[model samples]
Target: MKKIVSFTIMAVLIMGAAVMNGDYVSAASVDGLNDKINELEKKKDKIDEKQGKLSDKQKNTEEKMAKNKDKQAKVNNEINSIDQKLTKTRNKIQAKESEITETNQEIESLTGQIKSMKKKIENLKKEIKVLKERIEQREKLLKDRLRAIQSNGGSMRYIEVILGSQSFGDFISRSTAVNTIMDQDEDIMQTHMAEKREVQNKKSEVVNKKKQIEQKKKEVEQKKASLQNQKQDLESLTSKLNNQMSEKEQLMGELKEEHQKMEKYKMSVAEKQQALSDQAAVIAEAKEKASSEKERLKQLAEKREREAKQQKENSSSTSGSGSAAPSSSGGASTASSGGSGIFIWPASGSVSSGYGGRDLGYHYGIDLAPGYGAPVHAAASGVVTRSAVSSSYGNVIYIYHPQYDKSTVYAHLSSRSVSLGQSVSTGQTIGAVGNTGNSYGAHLHFEVHEGPWNYHSGINPFPYLP
Candidate 1:
């Protein structure tokens, strides 16, 4: 009997040790899960910070692009003005060229007139010379005739001829002959004077015509010179305008290049943000699982402790009764907290905006405005697919329900209390509603999707909600 009691005591000690060992293992597992969750939280924080910086950078880039657009507009206006000036300047230059051509033609015409007048002057001079020579010859011939008559017995010979006439008929005939000779000499003198006066007048007229034509040719040349100078000035101005336009165009091209670079950089930032979000989501999912496991293990450890205590108490009480040891009980059964194909309100608020056409544009979701920082709940029990910050969605969450083959989205959150891949029950608090990500006020933007969540692919959620 003493051996049996000692053996029974030894057996109780061993069973108690086994139960304590199981409890210790579960505790260690819970601690390790806690450590993992902390690590994941730190990673999520880092990703959030990165996302914030990216959003700021994107805003800055957009501001720069807006300024660039303004500058481009100004440059375009300047270019347009320059183009107009260039057009006018070119037109003026064309007109000047035409004037220059006309001036040249006038000069040519004047030159021809001047040349013709000069030729006429030369001809008149030649005629004058010939007329002077003929006058001198005629005067000398008349003087020679007078000398010949004088040498042959002058006036007395004429008187002798008239006295030598034999009858009255002969005297009358001699007198008539002498008168006719006097009349002929006077007529020759008058003709010589008239011819000399006519030649002088023609020479003077030709000289005056030549002078007029030369003056006109000089004026036309001066006009042509003025036109050429004007054309040169216009050409210079046109060149300057063209250069200015080229500079403006070059500036515009540079701005456009810069804009493209900025856009590419912005795209890169967005991509990085997305990658980081994905990474964070993955970490969150792990963390959520770890957390859930930690809780489960903690509960299991407590249960084991209670069982061990009860067994030890019973062993102490029945140590001498010779009773058999009780077998250990099974673990606590886990209940499914999955979706039931029933939707609920995601938030407590009045609907500020409805789904579909809105004043701003097409709205695929509904906006609910509660007080600021109101708790945002899940619409149904589902697994969290995404929980991340976004440029447009801000602090957002997406959940997918397998029962209904549908998804739900909650956006514009101030803070999130859930993690990716975490199972959530209907009306579970997942976040807080506040102004974030394209929101004008403190509100929750909620949506329901028939399938997986996609941008602007939500159906009206009102019908699903009671």
Candidate 2:
């Protein structure tokens, strides 16, 4: 847009310079110069109004950028918090793993103990069975001896045997013999009862030991199961934390992109403000020149009127003709009537992509393929408002035409020859087309805007291009 601003101010300057140099100045022409000055002032007011709007936009952009920064910071903080939680959860999981390991070992040990107790219990059962069989046989023998005595005559038979001894010696021997037999029977019965009680006690002790081991083993297994459950819970928590962290990081990345876009927009606004300031300078100079010319013309006309009156008094019949008005050769170049159209094709190639939506997405401008390093030209005579490298457009130039109140862009160039604020004519080489920025191949991206170029403000160039 600086291009259009400079062009209009230059026209005003030219007019003022012409009036200052003319030898025969006229009052009417000087008044016309004043009128031009007023017009320039009006333009200045409009520029001020635009600048004010731009200022508000810049402020809004900055505010948005600040908001984005805050959002990014918050996301970062959330990610950090998730990281901390993940760390703690992982630590807990590790601890649970250790507990589970210990619990498994304890269960194994308890199981071994239970197996040993079971074997002991089986051995006790076998020993008790043998003892019971031996005791039963001994008891049967005792019962048989008792039945024989009962059939014979019970106590009477034993008494008769004792009395029927042949002599005193024989009686003693028979009595001793009877006593020996009875003592042997009593010893057998006592031994059987003791053996049965010992077997029963051993069996009971083994059974009690087996029960204790089994109970201990069961408790250990339950502990292991609980540990396993706790570990599972920790693992689940860790997974959730990881997912949250990923989401937060993604949000942070998006916020960073938004911040960068806002920065670019803010820069564009600043460039426009600078252009307006330059135009204001031009208008001030033009106004000064117009006022000076007006004063000079008024004095010169007064001097001429005096001379004419003196001449009329000297020659009563001779009436002088007023000075002829200055010729209308306004010493300024007129606006260019671009040969056949308002704009010239910026590159020598067919359009690779047209303006509007396409398969990949929206195409804001036409893409031209004119080969690598091919020269790219301006579409019209205008001032260069932007000549810089952009992440998306690469080596690009922006020019504004005051004649049509429009702007044009040339982008994706191998190199740029013009700088910001430079004047360019239609068909002038400002750069060379090549693969630059977000381009697929060596090509030029051209755009035409009905007014000053802003983001996504491009219109179809086909209507205006020759």
Candidate 3:
């Protein structure tokens, strides 16, 4: 792309130079130079415009680059934050682990207490059974004693036993025996009843204690289940958080790559910009030199015009064409009619550059700014060797002159009027002025390539022209 730009500008420069060096020119010839001069002005304007556009584009590019960098930085920050979260989560996991350990210990402690309660419940059940048996035995003995009292006739049985005494002394002994027996029987019955009540109370106590232990067991089991669920929930949440962190890390990686690519792109753009600047310098230098050459040619034209005007006055009696070189262009005197190794102007245009490399890049041709659709003639008769659009030169035309061991390359032409392998004569129009592919503007970019590397044919066309 840069090469194309270089060629286009060179073509414009050559076109500008073409108008600056016409000998035997006059006001009449100004029409021909007018197009080229206008073209040069247009080129100057275009350069300014393009510079502005380029500046804007560069600014945008830089802004995009800065924004990308900032985005990458933000991504980095997010990654860091995620890392911190991961760290905190890990700590929480450790803490959770400790909590789990304590919960396990509690479960174990609860289990042991439950085991002890179970043993107590079992022992109480056995003690209650034993107490009930002992109470039943005491009640059975009291019932038998009551039965024996009833046999003696309940309340009257005691009196009848005392009255049935065999003698007075015998009766007294019988009565005493009956009273003592009844009292003893009553005492035994009361004691037995009391013992039975105590046994029932003891059984109730044991049953209540067993129920309390069972309730405690149920509570601990519920607590253990809850802790297990909590641990599972915590693990699941940790996994989700980890996944989020991983996603953030992946995002950070992508941002980093984009940032790196932008930096590399920035470097490349900067290098290309530098090259463009250098090329501009070279073009400026060429313009300065061409300007100097134009001044010299102009001075020479003025001197020749004065002499031609003198001669015209001397031949006042004959028909006058004014000057052979058309003094109308800048009022220059006519150029010499006959000269050795003379070549006619290939196209009517101002030369924008000389036959050497110019700035922006190695511009290998002189530029000629001709009128739109102007005829471009062959410098000398030769075979049309190459005619095509090139990657950098756009529409290009190449001619090979016989016996010169050299070739001329014309680039940035609008169209070619000749065919490859066709022979052309000197002064024959073989092409037209145009701005084609890779060309920034209209003009003819012309170059003379010498036989070999040591020849100026590719670098300079001055020595080859008359």
Candidate 4:
């Protein structure tokens, strides 16, 4: 009877020890889950901080882009104005050239006229010399006639000469000769006076014509000089305008380059923001799961403790309550299995192009034809690895599933609802599909990767989709 009583006590102690061991295991599990949840929460907070900085950067970049566009417009206007000025100046220069050409022709004609007038003056001088010689000869002849008349007692000589005739015919001839001598002397004086007057008129005409031609030439020369000055001014203006245009073009080029850089930077910030958002989402999901697990463990620990107490009490009375622990373990296994490796359709669309060779190059993703602004959802519960714009991709999103070692990409989105590092659930609306990047129309370019998300790391997404 003593041995039987000892065996009963030993069995009771063993049962008590097992109950305590089970309670310790449950409490430890709860503590571990709580610690994991705390770690995930911390990670989410860090991601949030990073996302805030990226958002600020994106805002600043957008502002810069706006200012750059404005500056570019202003530069373009200035360049256009400079071009107009250059055209006007060029036209003015051409007009001045025409005027100068006309003035030069006028100058040549005036020079020829001056030369002709000089030749005329020379001829007039020669004519005047011949007239003066004739006048001198005529004066000499008259003087001689006067001297002979005086030497022969003037009127008496004339009467003697007239009476010295041989017959009646001779007398008539002498009288005619005396009358012709007087008429000839009077004609010589009149001719000398007329020749002197003609010479004087010719000299006066030459002087006046020369003066007029010189004045005309002076005026024409002044006009040509004026035209030259105007042309020079126009040339200078054209040069200045060209310089201004060149400077404006250079500035515009620089501004364009800067604008491009800003766009790229803005895209990068957006991508970082998205990545952070996805990470935060993943952490939050993990925290939620850890919390749930902790609670479940706590409940299990309480249930086990109660059952242990009941078993101890029932052992004192009967023996059939040990099956409850294995049942609870099975329930925990079911819960754990419910939380992994599931995906859903990312968007509503028909596949327009499958992953393969394209016109330009190899297509890395499947193109989905959806109307603009169509809703895009997460393919699975995962962290957003990236969200941003690319020159080739436009707006895009990347979701990474750590559990499955898989990543999904959604490209050519018009707008995104979620940010970087955000956690997303399966079928959660993360963005809207639209024409973005190098796309021809509104569509979603979807990709799936078994490993890290990369351009070359993509596989055919059709096989993975439901």
Pairs that clash in candidate 2: 3-383
Q: Is candidate 1 or candidate 3 better by TM-score?
A: 1
Full-model lDDT, candidate 1: 0.74
Winning candidate number (lDDT):
2
Ranking by lDDT: 2, 1, 4, 3
User: lDDT per residue, candidate 1, 369-431, as tens digits?
Assistant: 887999999987767767878667778888876456577889889999987657788889999
Report the alpha-carbon TM-score of model 4 versus the true structure: 0.53
Worst-scoring 10-residue span by lDDT in model 4:
1-10
- lDDT (10s digit) by residue, model 2, range 87-132: 8888888888988888888888877777777787777788888888
Rank the models by TM-score, top first: 2, 1, 4, 3
Worst 10 residues of 1 by lDDT: 1-10
Which has the greatest TM-score?
2
Q: How would you encode candidate 4's per-residue C-alpha lDDT over 1-466 as one tens digit per residue?
A: 0111111122223433544554433455555456656665665676677677778878888988999999999999888888888888888888889889988998998999898888888888898899889888877987897898888898888788889989889999999998897787778778878898888888888889988999899999888888888888888888888888889999999999999889877866765565555445555555655566566567767886887777777776655444444322111111121233355668777888898988877888788887899999998766676777766688888877654557898989999887655667788999998898878989999888764354347777766665
Q: How many backbone clashes does candidate 1 have?
A: 0
Off by over 4 Å in 4: 1-33, 61-102, 122-160, 237-261, 285-384, 387-466
Candidate 4: global Cα-lDDT?
0.73
Query: Per-residue error at 24 for model 4, in Å?
Result: 13
